[model samples]
Target: MGREQEELWDAETAREYDTPGTGMFAPEVLGPTVERLAALADGGAALEFAIGTGRVAVPLARRGVPVTGIDLSRPMIDRLRAKADGATIPVVVGDMATATAPGTFRLVYLVFNTIANLLTQDAQVACFRNAARHLTPGGRFVIELWVPELRKLPPGRQAVVCRVETGYIGLDTYDTLHQHVVSHHFTFGAGRDARLFRTPHRYIWPAELDLMARLAGFALESRHADWNGTEFTAESPSHVSVYRLPHDG
Candidate 1:
């Protein structure tokens, strides 16, 4: 795990963290995702780890699912609280791996690949254990992340432009290493401000995640490639894995 990168998540970045995805259409991209998470949670209480800017929490709450959130960034939570009726949702500033609220939850969710920000195997495993501890009997822990690094290897490493707008082109670089892969994002704009966002993510196969869940005392309940219920396969780009707690002793 990298220490310097972890510290980069302080106030400054948290303030502008929503720049890339904070437009009016942000809810369009996030609302459906929250809906899927809401169903997995069984329409009860839901907890979100790293609920940045209430992007997922607010809409989930609008769906009648009482949502709570925990984040390491105070400014992010502040932005969330500043929204209309955002204060209605309870939020705590703490680390997801070690923080537990007063009560158990029917659904615990971590989305938008936030788990990778932990940057350590132990922290990742601790997140699993913490999620397990927060769930009620037969509760579910749902996560949305990308697939293994193996798919974006060799020939697939070629730089691909994802989004282009107003003379700006977004380029991505993929580096496949011994175990994990790193993505370098370079946003170029003609006569405009150019920026770079370097994000290193840990990739895990379905089998590996199943083992991790087993170790955390949860069992794999469902695995899908996307929020639309697409089948999970080797070629799938993303994953939505659900792990459930035992119903009885």
Candidate 2:
């Protein structure tokens, strides 16, 4: 990741990143995610790409699935260290696409649309190769990503509201030509200025992601609409995909 993009998720954002027991951190969302990953680890060590704030790693580790992480944000890693031991869930503060962690893993996973953070086809491809580098033969690499919502865009429209609540709202604006989406988050409070934070992502289609995996010497293993093992269909908004390296390789 570039300096500009790294700075986008500075300390302030890291501090507010964890929303325990609600939103993405809710038991309903996180539990199944960690469960499936733990199952994939299959009693072996695992590696996480862009593992932020111990959201999934902590619980997975508590389950006795040895977990390690590679991320780019020091502040985010600091927050994770505050929640868990750095020695137990060790993290390397560098780009996940290129950073090296010691040893091979039974499973290497990336979650929560983090693959899109690389922002370029080459970088995304490099990420798959990096995951392949870390995984044991026949090991799996999983990713959770939102399917592009381009069909929801009306003709000549480029923005949509993705979330609305009492104190927060999320708006995503598309750059269709470049296949980019910038999410603008607005938080409101009584007698205070509305706070805004934005994040940009380069979204990828499932087909393209599969091709990237293939280029990295992996084959698509499975895909589901969510962590519950639900069937993926045309209407599913997001997908959890698994890719595996050849046992011989």
**lDDT (CA) per prediction:** 0.75, 0.93
Candidate 2 Cα misplacement greater than 4 A, ranges:
none
Q: State the lDDT of candidate 2 residue by residue for 86-199, as single tens digits.
A: 889999889999999998899999999999998888999999999999999989999999999998899999999998999999999999998889999999998678999999
Residue 29, model 2: lDDT of 93
Worst window of 10 by summed lDDT in candidate 2: 240-249
Model 1 lDDT per residue over 1-249, tens place: 244544656566767666545542365667668779878878679999988787788778888888888777766777787763544788877888888765779999988777876756677888989999988899998988876545434574645454566644555444444234455555565655777766666656667778878889999989988777889987887798999999977
What's the lDDT of the predicted structure labeled candidate 2? 0.93
In candidate 1, which residue ranges exceed 4 Å CA deviation?
1-6, 19-28, 84-87, 155-178
Q: Pick the lDDT winner.
A: 2
